[model samples]
Target chain A: MSGVRKLVLLGTGLIGGSFALALKRARLVQHVVGVGRNATNLERALDLNVIDEASHDAAAAVAGADLVLLGTPVGQMGALMQQIAPVLAADCIVTDGGSTKQDVSALFRQHLPRHLSHCVPGHPIAGSDLSGAAAAQYGLFEGRRVVLTPFAETAQNALEQVQTLWQQCGARVYTMTPEQHDGIFAAVSHVPHLLAFAYMNAVLAKVDAQPCLDFAATGFRDFTRIAGSHPEMWRDIAVANREAILADLKACASQLQHVIALVEAGNTEGMEDYFATASRARVAWGQRHK
Target chain B: MSGVRKLVLLGTGLIGGSFALALKRARLVQHVVGVGRNATNLERALDLNVIDEASHDAAAAVAGADLVLLGTPVGQMGALMQQIAPVLAADCIVTDGGSTKQDVSALFRQHLPRHLSHCVPGHPIAGSDLSGAAAAQYGLFEGRRVVLTPFAETAQNALEQVQTLWQQCGARVYTMTPEQHDGIFAAVSHVPHLLAFAYMNAVLAKVDAQPCLDFAATGFRDFTRIAGSHPEMWRDIAVANREAILADLKACASQLQHVIALVEAGNTEGMEDYFATASRARVAWGQRHK
Candidate 1:
């Protein structure tokens, strides 16, 4: 129930900026320090009152902070962790908004072994196509789910504090091992993005791709929505969670092969049942979610 | 252009019902007769003024009709065509809202051989998850594209009538051979639906599928939106456009294999480029279309 005396966001982009703003609005944070290599984005965060101060030096920004959020892409988190480890207060609680968790867990063990108890690796399921500080809003995490993949050495008090912070932001917090979180996300989020990208390439490979795209309608719009995601970020995610994502991708490829065989053989009954199983499940899922 | 004197809908669902409403709004048709196995749905069409009369007999419905629009699953088209062929007027036009065209072209040749000159196969890209007569709306095809695949034997006058009728419904009409229309749709629409179904089945095969589904977010929602489509309808489309759909499915499988190799080798640069190609194109497409 103790408030953060100084909160630091190592990457003041959408996720980081929104978290800082939410905590500030909740009166749970006294001072927010925005740290990023993007000077303009960091300045925007400060101008938008998402942070009380802005700094390019992540190491210096966490010097006196009670809570520090590593909100950058997972690929950038390791170096930031190493830089801040030397300056971090002994009692400071560390958390992240990374999409993947196992790699971040490894980074925690490798760079901040002594601070494992203070590190709470989290993934807030609140991503949008928009990014950077300007995309930050006051309620980005409202009614969203935040998953914490806390390692074995994570302190109970640190975990509770991180959970409470997310709950204060109107996010429902769930805890799982880094492995479970990675596998689940690989199946649901990462695999779908990869398939969408693959499907887009399939269309592009066509000789009449331009005309086909011109004639594409609403169905194509929804199917390829994720294919339009940020490439660098997705590439990093695919590689970071390589094993789990690879497994899911292979599963998808195998399913696709089966579909190809059914279509090639003109197996109407089999194809119909196959399509029906997935179709029925998807409709059920949509209704349940609605 | 002369309007339809007595328009008959062979299957008064979304497509048929909507066309009737649009024609009624444009005052292009004198009377609209709705025909379907579902008496309740036909009654709804009449109640909504989507039709002036309801009939369960396809042959009886087409007896005095100057224009008969078959708007049911492609699988049901053959039976309805056979039923109405005996009663169709010599000068009457036969059209359809089937998604696939090649099979309907074949059906026109097989069951309604004498009426081939009057048969105008069309595909209105005005699909929605909601079907039934109650889902009919006058603006369903407003600004949408409707493709008409007229056979070699299709009369020029009949073609013009169908084209003019669609234009009056606020749809831009394009004419192509059934082969060309099937190829384009297989690449864009049919293949994507199959891929989404495959992706859904892949997720279902995972050990922690329930948890994966539970954690699925917006990316998953948009990616699988097409997977929730009508199973029987897609099955008919897949089987009807078997050759083209098969070719596209194999093309997609090949693309998936390439992606697997890229990820399996941890080819970050290749994967990034692959994703960037799709992302850039999709964004450009979104901008251009907007």
Candidate 2:
């Protein structure tokens, strides 16, 4: 397949900028345009060669572009889709690097109904605590997984083109329904962030919170590291993936209650069995993941 | 002050072996005898020079020893204390490397009533997933915190000797009552381990648990890292620190319920504030810790 003639990035932050940089390294896109509200970040992207041009107007930036990536937070993606709907080229393969799929899918249907055939919703599973154009790097997606959730009306060619582009950036691409993508991510990514935040809040609630934190060691550090995630970003995720998040949170709460009962009863044997199940599975996961 | 003439390590493992190694590095101990049920592990400790002598009998090993460190699990510490009580030297300083303190303090009182004045219980904050004599290292306690929970009857001279030994091993030492130590650790270390174990168990309860584990990334890895901890050891902790662990687990459960309510009601602003509170504190902690 031939390279993209022009590619526009809806948000010039880590995810979008990294995508542009990777595409540039792979020589899969001729010219890249980064659009964002942050002037300094856009300028930095240009200076760093993450994009060939920078634009403040999303609508103007997507005109005549063969590819557009919605890399903004889920809260901002609807308005972005609305902005580009009237200006996006007929054959442009529109996709996103959103964490959740269902909300982005609805946005696509609501704002870009006429362009549904060319629209694709995807999630690149390369999350980080860092952000901004400056945090972008060429190998961000290398050996990563990207899931594309295509609507029924989405053209096969458009879906394949998006998948191929991610593959060019050294990602392994998988296709799943939007619901599947949302459910899987809710279990793995979204729920863990929420749990970490909840655990942190619980720690903060202690009367001896400062001393508790002072004495916290490596175990506490690793367990609550994700609690330091971006607030508004995670908030949007909680709302967007509410149902799945709620289910997982409830499950975790139930698990915690069971643990309390075991400890309350001083049931060492039961606690051992409970912890052993988790420990075995976690050890197996580490072996596989590493 | 002066070095220990002879040090006896009961149930020699990672903690015991590392302590012996660090003391040797500081030239603060004349002789180290490692005692354990496992003959192979004892032999390994001797081979690694973590111990100058290997003994199968805790009682025999403590005979005429000036210092005896009960570096075993809380479960085994009671029996070892019983075994050594009859033979321990009059001025010998007995301490432990137990994670939970109150129970270890009780064990000392129950078995070594006459030796209470010379007993000082401590917890070294340098925890690792690795275990056994082979995991021992010279600098394991370097820059680490060692909390010593002394009995009211504990002699200042005995406490100072243990504190000075840890300081010589490159550790910062703090003193507290066993109750305070247990409460702080339950909030920080023990509860987090239980929570991670609960979270992992929750994931395992899912019908599609394998798929979820397959997609588990860095956040899941870090958040549930403690879930891979030794089950029997954690079970012992859960029993030993039951009251504190239960209190914190309940608090955590309540926090999760609040999060569930926020997401269920689509209260994005409320969720944002909740996440922001945790995110800010966690970020501040990372800055301080680094």
Candidate 3:
């Protein structure tokens, strides 16, 4: 812990930039170096004070850093890991800020060096609709949940170090299996995004549709906000976690069918009861969580 | 407009309560008299300064007020209007905070006295998941939309007065027909709520479901928060606006079927394009609106 001075952040977009800022705010990292494909974005990160320095060279950026954090889209993790694997120091700890965990873990296991016992896969359940380094802000992870899914072979010391870092960033860390993390997120996050995307597409496809954009109230905005996220990133998430996403979709489909049947049958009381229960559950959960 | 002093706010819950607070904050209304069934809520309204006074008698509340605003659930508006119809002054302006417009308009035409030419039916396109007078807060209407659906018979002066009042309360007002308002809201608000309710219900009904609540992330929380809204209110909105609600549901259903077909056919490219277009449209719409 005493020797952990330099930190290298891969993909200096929202997540990476936020991580860099949080670390700096907490004074956990002595120097934060940002790595990204976009040189302009790296410069913007510097201007925004998201990182101490910007570097386009991935391998060189990870060369002597004590901690390396991957904040790339889920799809790019494999290639980025492979590119940095050769240059990464054996004792340097690596973590991620991806949405899905299973694929990222698989990629690390496949590409990362055997001596890199410090490679720990993680996902912070924190984000916004805004993208890029400019959207980053200090304390973005404060009071947010950060889930770390470590493999059985992952070194205890490495896990502890990553967990401690997230704690210092003001995130409450939870540990779960990669499978559990994927399944839960599919039900809660991925499926919701899919539904929003699908719904928006449907609304748009209607030729004579009214000006939905003009008439869209706050409810519509809130429901569709996640639909505005990076399509390629979401596409990767959908394909990578296909089975779990499908399961959640099927569950949603069945529920919709049930409600449709009741509506068709004129079962007003039944429909009311169903909605009432959902409303009560949501209110209670929100109150308790908030 | 100068003589419009006393304001009677019926059903002092979320919309009505917030309106009262906004009016008081802006000093637009000299006195806001709240009328509702719940004595505790009415007392809380007075205690929280959402209303200047409380009255259990709807007729008494409307007797001296220059502006009468119905803030009850849409289904209850007709009955409440009937209860106060005889006591309503000829010169008083009557409006509503209901979501759907057609039923309320029909109810007003039927039950309201013909001498009361000042009846202007309106729907404030803003609210939160929280209900009751205690949840009311100032600035709820800031930069939000309020739709006023005035019939041909509606008095022009009355409409202008109501529009000015809403403007003073910090809302941009739009004009539309009752049918148009209902149709647009069905697509934007009612259908979205149904989807949320149906989605959450489906997750809960899963036979081998994991602990979804424990793992529910911000996405789930945001998407389902409206599901926790007042069941009775939503039930009323859905049933009263059944035709438009069904139309919106069919639209969403057709879109879902298309996605399912593409997924089943292994048309990955088509699915990706579908999602991408939707994502792009939503991102553009959100940016503009925000």
The models' CA-based lDDT, in order, is: 0.90, 0.91, 0.83
Where model 3 places Cα greater than 4 Å from the true spot, the runs are A113-116, A207-210, B25-31, B113-116, B206-211, B259-272
TM-score of the A chain in candidate 1?
A: 0.96
Candidate that scores best on TM-score: 2
Q: Total clashing residue pairs per candidate?
A: 0, 0, 0
Which whole-number lDDT from 0 to 100 does residue A230 have in model 2? 87
TM-scores, one per candidate: 0.95, 0.95, 0.92
lDDT of 1: 0.90
Q: Which is the winner by DockQ between candidate 1 and candidate 3? A: 1
lDDT of candidate 1 over B1-290, digit per residue (tens)? 99888999989999999999999889899999999999889888888999999998888888888999999999999999999888889999999999999899889999999888999999999877668999999799998999999988999999999999999999999998888899999988999999999999998887788999998988899889889888888889988998988888888888888888988898989999999999988878777766
Clashing pairs in 1: none
Residues B1-290, candidate 3: write the lDDT tens digits. 45358989889988888887788777788888999999999999999989989998898889888998899888788888888888887888899999888888889889985844788899988867778999888888889999999878888899999998889889999999988888878887888898999988877776534466766767778788789888778878877788888877877877776766665555667767888898888887877788
The parts of candidate 2 lying over 4 Å away from their true place are none
lDDT of 1 by residue, A57-173 (tens): 988888889999998888899999999989999999999999999899999999999999999999999877667899899988988899998878899999999999999999999
Local accuracy of candidate 2 as per-residue lDDT tens digits, A1-290:
67898999999989999999998888889999999999999999999999999999999998999999999889999999988888888999899999999989999999999999999999999988778899999899998889899999999899889889899999999988888888888988998899899999999999999999998888999999999988988988988988998898888888988999889988888999999999999989999988
Clashing pairs for predicted structure model 3, backbone only: none
Q: What does the lDDT come to for candidate 3? A: 0.83
